[model samples]
Target: MTRRGVIAAVLGSAVAGHIVLGVVAGGAALTAIRAYAAPPAEPVFPAPARPVSPIVSPRWSTERARNDAGEARTVIAALAPLNGRTVADIGAGEGYYEPPLAHAVGRKGHVIAEDIDAATVTRLARRVRPLANVAARLGRPDDAALAPASVDVVLMVHMYHEIGEPYALLWRLRRSLRVGGRIAIVDADRPSGEHGTPPQLLACELGAIGYARTSSRPLGDGVYLAIFEPRALPDTIRVCR
Candidate 1:
């Protein structure tokens, strides 16, 4: 072959060899293209599958659930007997609910005050130290980090909608409940971003998470109480879809 033809042939052969090995060339140099599989496609996160109507705007302060016109009385009425049992107050800001929950659970019982923020947990840990029966725990966006089958009741007061990963969180939370443990939610009937979740949407999410809404009652002032019992959930959650 002519000198130019010989060089072209060699280069062409090099490229053909690479193609046979399944690597694509990117530059004019005859360097071997590393056959790399495209990095595994990123996982697609599940999105809210359905539209559940929500209520309106920044939620009420922790004080709202703490008082809210006898809310403490309302919560006490909704739960199973509080004496001698374990209770979880999720998103337990300022540890406001821990004292009462501890009191209701009695000295024989225990109350776990949980929050996702480390600062919040630190403060809560110190806040509940004097309560004896009350303790603080640090949780995650998708898990409350409570021990398995540890709590008799989970109080999601005014913070259900604030759960950034509700499906995963609730699914995992089922393992934290005792045999007949129950969940309680107290939220306004507004949009979630607005810090509210409508009752119907609340029930749907609970059912999806393998919880059955057993009792629901008006707590007045736009807030309502919902009690749910743990049930068998499917192998995979469908999210809001």
Candidate 2:
């Protein structure tokens, strides 16, 4: 074959290779652009198996329940200004806090006591029957039973971390609060004592869900209380504590 012919063949092959490279590069760039423009997928969280039957038995001792009730009364007193307004207690176990809150809110105000366990809700219903303003509802893993924007305050006491779907629950709680509403999340420094939620992580999660840490106080003997208010809500018109 002639030298010119060989050179011409080499040039043709080089051009074809460049064309292939250009096509591959263009395809990759288009794929990257499409990926960048697409909206992110929603976060997926695992759902634990629900109990076949609700845990109805009182989890706390009678004396312990009384102590908890007393502590709850103090907290409700601190939230005294929210009187005469609708409120929801998320994870209201055994209806311990409902009676005190019911007394605080009086007849005009309502308390929606919610728990994930149906048996607990039944127990709470019976326990709070004397208080006409208290209503018991079963909450789901991802949602509470309260109406959107219907509550003046939402309270979660020593129960936020036990929720399996914390983010989803927080979103639900956020929607439940009224325009000027407040959310008071009270958890012990050690939730379960042995393997409880770390206070710092709780604060971080609450902050992510638009709660501002307003105040904290030591309850007694290694237990600390933290108060958080919704960042989007208006300032407290009347300071209770």
Candidate 3:
């Protein structure tokens, strides 16, 4: 007879003591459980509201940044103690950061070049094939798919804004960090599509995911590098399906 009455009738009898909700449209049924018994989980920061950047070849960005008045050296310095350690290059376009990572970690160490696109990973695999220490792997939009406690450093250069699911991704990153490991994010203060993430917002999102920003400095030539360490106890991460 009424909206509430019809909903109750459809969800009737089965949920005796609990609240129920159902939506019927075009002969399709969608049922939802409304257990108001306990408080709902808190919401995490939403993804940035900005245009997504077009994925480009690493040849344009990778080496150029390296040549910029020691930008590459400064980034490596922030991720210090990387010798003989494992590193991940999230969104490793064209294997741009792989060579440096491989060199820094040395022959005893390994580098995981992870990208969300299969083609990108394939190309990166080919690009880094010359380096014995570097390998490429495909990653998901919401997860980098890194092994637990397997990486000493994770680099997200000019790519944090391109991530579709930052909260889930950042949370997943926590599972990849070893003790004393660090995350280095490089970007400018411009809008997302313009190739940058505001340092304050970047810190806030990472902080929400249980990362503590240890230091930040100008990455030379406008880009900024912020370094963060994982907290001892991570907060309950919100999984984005």
Candidate 4:
């Protein structure tokens, strides 16, 4: 073949390869630009809003109710010595303990059964209406509806850990107690296995809220009881069960 012919063939091949390379590069750049312009994917679903009131349905669950009842009885026994005295049962579900507590306090002493749920409040009111000494209270998210420094005892049975705002509730409870008023916290001793707060964490949180750990004793095979009181009060005011 002639030298010119060979040179022309080589030059033609080089131009063709250059064109192919340019096309590939342009295609890749276009793909990248398109990917960059695409919008981000939306979330699968929106998160539900935080509730304003305590969840009542969870309290009425069969297992929870039974646990609450047993803990309520223990709390009653602990406060039994305070006969004919004012008591407030915070988070009183289904009024299971309100009736007996009202009876213990007698017609003269007052019992405030406070629940955050309006439905639970209604149930409590119906259960305690016959008793003149008992008053059903519907609580707000930030505070209990009880009168400040009016209650001689505050009972929170198997319900403290479930509170959405523990610090706010504890502060309100502290304010509600009389000079020598006592606070009782009863909860499951063992781990719930669910993602609920553990008993030790409850005690620690209560202690942080100015409550002194008075006693921690066994309630049943797997359950335990803890009693706490304001650190400023005398030791005799807070009784351990």
Residue 124 alpha-carbon offset, candidate 4, angstroms:
1.7
Q: What is the C-alpha RMSD of each candidate to the true structure, in Å?
A: 16.5, 15.9, 14.4, 23.9
| Candidate 4 residue-wise lDDT, 1-241, digit = tens | 8999999999999999999999998996665443223122321221112222234352535756666657556667766676779988888887767777877888678888888888778877887888898888888755786776688888876665456666556656776777667888666654433323356666666655557777777776556667776653222222111
Candidate 1 ranges beyond 4 A from true positions: 1-45, 49-68
lDDT of each: 0.75, 0.68, 0.75, 0.66
Residue pairs with backbone overlap in model 4: none
Residue-by-residue lDDT tens digits, candidate 3, 19-99: 433323422222111111111343464664456677665544446646766766778877777889998989888876777
Return the lDDT, model 2, position 119.
80
**Any residue pairs clashing in model 3, and if so which?**
none
Ordered from best to worst TM-score, the candidate numbers read 1, 3, 2, 4
Would you list the rank order by lDDT, best first? 1, 3, 2, 4
| TM-score: model 1 vs. ground truth | 0.74
TM-score between model 4 and native: 0.66
lDDT by residue for model 2 (76-184), tens? 8777775689989888888877877888888889999998888888988898888899999998978896776688888877665566666557656766766566777
> Candidate 3: TM-score?
0.73
